[model samples]
Target: MEFMQADREACDRLLPGLRERLLELPLSELESADSPALALFREYGGTQLLIPADRGGLGASALDAVRVVRVLGGLAPSMSVATAMHHFSIGMLYSIADLYGKDTEIEPILERVSGEKLLVASGFAEGRSNQGILSPNTVARPVPGGYVVDGAKKPCSLSRSMGLLTTSVAVPRADGTNEMGLLLLPADTPGISVHPFWSTFPLAGAESNEVRLTDIFVEPTKILRPPPGLTAQLSELEEAGTIWFQMIVTAVYTGMVSRLAALVLERGRGAATDRARLLMAVDSAAMLAEGIARRVMSGDTGNDCAAAALVTRFSVREVLTQALDLAVELLGGMSYIQSTDVAYLTAAVHAIAFHPPSRTSMTDALLDYYAGKPLVMA
Candidate 1:
């Protein structure tokens, strides 16, 4: 808890500098599909925000990380979305071992991350089609000395700058079933390549492209496996990573809505009621998500965390959509102008629901939770 507080403070302390940098970038370039906003963000040591203090990282708690991303989302939506991949990956990698009691050799990588300030990108599966981010899309074939992983993660963020990739793959078990295993390796390993895939202008800075791994060899030391009966226990680990991803990604969009609300305050009239309503709604959504994060950090990963995250994400997306509508309606005709930032922001806000654990999946999961059934989404 103390460490979490410290991380929160570190984020707060750096918010001003991040905001300033975003303001300095030109609106046109910032909206380009090939923006340098992320490059500039890294120059400010943003890569270290989620690293643990023991490993020379910021030791940011879930709350601290959320606050940082929320603020950045407003200033630079693409950068925030891009970095959320790294932060959530770090969150799971740093905490999962301790939670599950596996001495996964991750400290060396964490040390390298801290000392070298290397950026880590996520190749975790996301969205409704993926079902769950932990469900490995890649396959790991066992060999004499190690496993050969072959698959690809499309729309992988931080494509150009990441020095390492953190992902999971399915390994066949002797029991005629497949179990999930998390893997980490250097991004520059032979047979690993990044390709251009993202074309969305508002989010171009995220550099979300395709990362292909072709028969990449990984030793046992680089993989973390659950104890016996992984199928029964897989949900615990999956929820841990999912909660972290949903929380931070939701915060990223909240930051955008926040900026839109502030704009209403600056340049609108006769919309005080609407502005107040929007701000209140955004805050409520944020607080609800924060409550869920606190529980997950406090060691609660049962149906409660999974259910809350699904609902919070659903609610946040709805709130943000409404807020964006109010923003345009309040700002009047000027908002439609192509050159204006509001137009770009409005477009970016719609991409929130497109993230992961799609509405269909969450709806099913939420119903199961309410009906007192095992909280699993197929």
Candidate 2:
């Protein structure tokens, strides 16, 4: 309709006036590491957008969540990307909380997340070439009462501002094998520290750095182990995680490119046909993302849905890549030379391809899924 009009309205309703505040700040400030965007996001209740209303959250549906993320992506790219990780982590926890009763330990964490507006950072294995997102990046040694965790997550978004860190760890089993489990630990836990890692300037405000944990002790109650016999393929929780991650991330990049496309439309940078093609590319990608979110809301977040999410993500990546290149050209060389904003957005939009489960790595898995095989991440 009016270029993310409904999604912008959803943002205003969820976190009133957040867009205005982000707009007031310069793009350079929002893209810098010292940016106040994250703090502003926290103040605006952005952290509680995905939690269920019964648990003190607004309990927005999956469809609306992606819309909100798309709006944020247009205004503040780094904040949107960083918060996507938070939503992914919390989504996993709450999904488990729904499975288990309220008596579980996850209940308190959910309360703090909704009540305290605490941000949770995801520490899944990413940035490693040819590695699956489910692969544990941290090592957990069995100890009395719990386990000793030692490892690190590089390019971990929200590294500095996260109140809690949710990481995937390889838990030692009695038979000398390993099982994938999620570990929840407070950010202030001993041995947990953040180091400068992300050197990229586009999303420096995301606080994507190295989060190191050395000999960190975790209680048994804090670990959520997936059901057994999920070693071959995706677990239910993993599927949900994958679906949410793909949907949210795809929306973020779509918004980034949409911003550029908006500028082209506003300035009437090129011929009518060229402008129509640009809008088509951006709108198609947004619709693809919404499709995944719709599948999630319909209680269809299974292997097929996960495969569809990945397929949509990759498809959107290609569409947006072409759209971005066309937008930059349409905007003309003078616009790119006159301001840093256009260049910055161009650099940031290219990062979609760099996210986990790269196209090359997921090619075989996607082909197999298309051939009636289960979608496996390796």
lDDT of each: 0.76, 0.88
Off by over 4 Å in 1: 1-16, 99-104, 128-131, 142-145, 173-177, 227-234
Q: Would you estimate the TM-scores of all the predictions? A: 0.88, 0.94
What is the Cα-based TM-score of model 2? 0.94
Q: Which ten contiguous residues of candidate 2 have the minimum total lDDT?
A: 226-235
For candidate 1, write residues 1-378 as lDDT tens digits. 321233235455854376677778876687576787777666777888777777676666777777777777887888888888888777777766565563457767767877877788987776437367677878998998998999998888988778889887898888878877888778888978989898767788788899899989988767777666656456666777777778888988888887777767766634578777876877776777788779877988776787778788888899889878887788777566745688888888899878876787557667767898866754
Residue 318 in model 1: lDDT = 92
Cα deviation of 107, candidate 2, in Å: 1.6
Candidate 1 backbone clash number: 0
Model 2 C-alpha lDDT per residue in residues 11-47, reported as the tens digit of each score: 8988998999999999999989998999999999999
User: Where does candidate 2 stray beyond 4 Å?
Assistant: 126-134, 226-234
